[model samples]
Target: MNDSRSRWLALAVLALAQFMVVLDVTIVNVALPAIQTDLGFSAEGLQWVVNSYTLTFGGLLLLGGRMSDILGRRRLFLIGLGLFAAASLAGGFATSEGSLIAIRAIQGIGGALLSPAALALLTVIFPAGRDRNIALGVWGALAGIGGTLGVVAGGVLVDGLGWEWIFFVNVPFAVVAILAAPAFITESRRVQGEHSNFDVAGAILGTAGLFALVGAVIRTEAAGWGSTQVLALFGSAVVLIGAFLFVEARAKDPLVPLRLFRVRGLSVSAIALALNGGAFLGMFFLTALYLQQVHGDSALEAGTHFLPMGGAAILSAVIGAQLVTRFGTRAAYLGGSAVGAVGLLLLSQAGADATFAGGLLPGLIVFGLGLPLVGVANQIAAVAEVPHEDAGAASGVITTAFQVGGALGLALISTTATTRTGDLLAAGAVQTDALAGGFERGMLIAAGLAVANLVIGAVRAPRIRPDAAMVAEASAA
Candidate 1:
């Protein structure tokens, strides 16, 4: 009984930490205009505020995951929390754009460490079956809400306190999480022989490859895709990625054991997760821009506009958890994707004259409902077949897909919207109307991606039965 109590407490602590990490990804969206005004960021340069964190977070995740398994989850989790707190403090005090961007990147590294360790700990604590399913439901719910929560918090902080408060806000949460972690969470390490050494070469190759790839994608806005600089970066990324794969195939203890991909569920989940991340992140960014730029809303008002969506996401996440237990992962994901696509299509109708009630609210609620279903379902499917020792690796893969896909998707959406806006300007349209048209086009693209996710979920995601162990345990109880 005491053990169960401890597990629940540990889960609360871990979920709180996870919320902080995920919140940072979108908290800045509501504060972007403020940050840009104060920091003198060019429109293109402003993207780095978000991408710097995501790039490092995505790049180092596999390394962080393996480190957690090798060193110990508790140790890594503590270390990560400390780094994150320190970085947040630095970010709050930043005097220049370079300093803030650099600090955010460090924070991402800390997140890369903190996130997977927390997730691996969750997986270790909850035995696979009903208990794990329930715990994950709670975890996914927190994750689903965290993004919207950030928007709300960012609005309040930026409006009431200052843009810097968004960074400052993390400090208290991190301190509390760090202080409370040791008591509730137990230490865990991979049970494999102690002689297993960290794969240094694989880490370097993988991190560098991902950073370069994402950098190249972001560069396409300024440097055309066929430009010499972009071509070179792309070539380097391909080579580095190829080398990483080769090393993983040969390394005695690889950072990412390529063997894990053999699991059909994990493989499909990774692909679907990438698509979902791209669409999800792009939608938030475009919508926020639409509200602030086109509708002439304040940051606080824009944040409040998202409240309905957040509520719907929370409700759908609970239903998704139950669906996972009954029908299976595939059905939940497919159904969610179809619903999300419809929502995106509806959202594409927003224009300069559109009202929040008639134009945004309905689509926002419907999309919010489907978004959590995809997130929760993909998360469960990604790690379902992973062994205990590789739990961290699986968690890392899931998050890496999310962060990387978000970065890439944001780049695509931004580039496409900018081009369309420029074309409209050339054709003699007013700036506001052109901007709104560009945003709507981006929404349509996002809808198309959702359709692709639905197809993948239907074709690739395998149906999963409840673990026999869970059934046996229930029968005995």
Candidate 2:
């Protein structure tokens, strides 16, 4: 009933909601084989099970954030949570590939609403100081661990229960969060202001443009970058985004105020987080491939290997909070990025004959440790200096940056690795050797991206004032 206990409880609910959303991002990967067997999905068609959710989630995030600012955060959070739970329940019973994909898309819509609203709530709930930094560290840790845990959980569920249990599992967590949310979390929106009309045109253009952009990026995995469909989508995205920017400049009220970009912390953090996300996801993708295809690990075995990663990230998050508290976000982020680059470089040394302990484990532990450091610092930096009214929009940009960047990075890494494998195969290499070589190349590319993150952090990162910005009213309703 007291303010302090209530805020922490509210965080627990929000973190649970966010963890569920993040879990869905990767939980379905391990279940894909089971899903294909049951639903008779074509190899190509099955990829959409993952792509549909990511693209839709990435595309609609900005709109969701703006809507949160217009509507209430608590209201949007509850609505999104309800939609997500219902879709997950429906997805468990899907008899056809089409039905499952559609449900996943709906889940993505829920995520777009829920993710930003939840993050914005954190920004508003914890004032700028040590408490907010600690809160964000917990958030970053859970988010990082969620991806790893998804694989572990998916493997266990798919092997123990049916694949449907993966979807079924979300229902109980969502129900608990939905029930507990209103008791602790309070409704808040952008303070009442003049020119309150929503920017419908900006919403349409911006959402459509982001949708097209993410679509083009996703298509690049199957269709080459130069393919007609990919090019057309890219062109459409460019024009629509250009139009959206033009409209926002002149609109009485913008869906996302252009001025928000001027916030040094938010802008720099978005870019840095994008690069960090790229490296992080690329590492995970390549490692998964290396473990399964190269080392002959089963899905469940590979998932278990990632448990160390989750553990390392938890410890790193605690250290990251201290680093941010003592030094600042910039110092912590730069340090983390450097460590991540080193981790990726170590992973690049893995060979066809590599043993898990000798080759893979060290890199996995190091990368995991560095990941949450970058994550926690960016989480704080992104919103620490943002105005109260635009907290939702700021959260949206940060998350969209990470998601879209991961998509782009994965595409690039996959292509590079595939091309390298093809080249090695042509040169008379064995299948496993070629696969290992390809994975090595991919890890190297990820390392390069991590190094790029370090450069961005060192050069462009904002020096955040710990006690300024991000304080907002948190009165209980």
Candidate 3:
């Protein structure tokens, strides 16, 4: 293939790898009931199916990103892919819940490794210009689409085939990407030098800390925030993460370079991504509940309801890249965030009698259309200007922000909904009405988060100048 054709083909491979990883995040959700029934999972124990993956993926992401930099991106990508595929296959044959959960955790590890390497590869593959913008736009779009599509795909696969197919489905995609990757993707990593230490202690602390933190966040949905186990985990996470920061500051070569934060727009983008994650991911969770419980949609019907949102996200992501290329990341982020907040506010008005067309579609479409602008912009801002050697690290940090942010957002939103529902139920409200009331309050909080993202962008988002490589593209345009 010619160079241009090669890069685009490589992007397809990388994006496919990432799509499978992200799809796993939510694909299993629709099949949870089926898995529970077949595998004899207890009501309380069933959550581990999801939590195991979340905890490992979120915890190991930074380490995986850094490892990709230390090792080669292609090498790590393949290794992660192999691990993920194997785990998925194993999961397909799992006869017990424990075995399945174990396999899912392994899948998380694979995802943590694959996602950043795939993104880092994009940074190197496309260069810093219109091409990179478009590439990242596709990457950002898939990030949103994978989550939404997972629901639809899950419902289809589960209904048509079986729950095992969810795990089995990953193998073919993984095999194709693995076979094609060598032909298109180039191998790249940090240069070796005198200061190329790997910061073993920092890695241990950071990984454990993130694990503890994510674990605590996941538990908060089931265990109240004040529960002894949750509190202890939270405390441990704070202490360990604090120590990791301290160690990184002094290390000769840290796992996460302290200086990376000084990169223009990075810190601001990280914060914004976190808020963006909290708002939109929370919206998805609540929206799913609203569709199923209030609107009386089956799993397939609810997943179908998200099709508009998914379509809007894909369109917005393409437009967002153009906006970034023309206007800049700051402008796109601010405008997009504002639109997203409006979408959430509209969603906040849905009541028990809410119809899909009147009450849900508008918000879903607008919200979907808006946040991906932030996603595409945030992604570009986070990684575009960073030194090539740190591309993996930069991608890792950005991805971590989104995952951690999503976890935090979902926890807060779910808790709010649960509390409101409980209160309404106690006061004699019908189940559907109480559920709707709770969902409204949850969406309102999500809207508030989006507004906060807008405010942050306005206040802190820096003006990003196009690189020299982009100048020719700009002049041509």
Best by TM-score: 1
Computed on alpha carbons, the lDDT of every model, listed in order, comes to: 0.82, 0.79, 0.80
lDDT of 2 by residue, 133-161 (tens): 66775676566678778989987888788
In model 3, residue pairs whose N, Cα or C atoms come closer than 3 Å (at least 3 residues apart or on different chains), thus clashing, are: none
Q: What is candidate 3's lDDT per residue for 1-477, written digit by digit as tens?
A: 239999999999999998898788767776776787789985345646765676577667877777887789899999999999999999999999889988988998899888778877887888776887677657655666787789899878887888899999999999999999999987998677633565768867876786677667656656778999999999999999999999989987776777889986778888888888888767876776678768988667777888898888878865666777788878888999999999999999999998999999999999988987887677777776789777556766776777767766766776677778878999999999999999999999899889999999998888675543442222111
Worst window of 10 by summed lDDT in candidate 1: 468-477
Better by lDDT, candidate 3 or 2: 3
Instruction: Please estimate how well model 3 matches the true structure, expressed as its whole-model Cα lDDT.
Output: 0.80
Off by over 4 Å in 1: 1-9, 122-137, 183-186, 192-195, 384-392, 467-477
Please give the ranking of all candidate structures by lDDT, highest first, separated by commas: 1, 3, 2
Cα deviation in Å at residue 406, candidate 3? 1.1
- Better structure of 2 and 3 per TM-score: 3
For model 1, how big is the CA root-mean-square deviation? 3.6
Worst 10 residues of 3 by lDDT: 468-477
Better of 1 and 3 by lDDT: 1
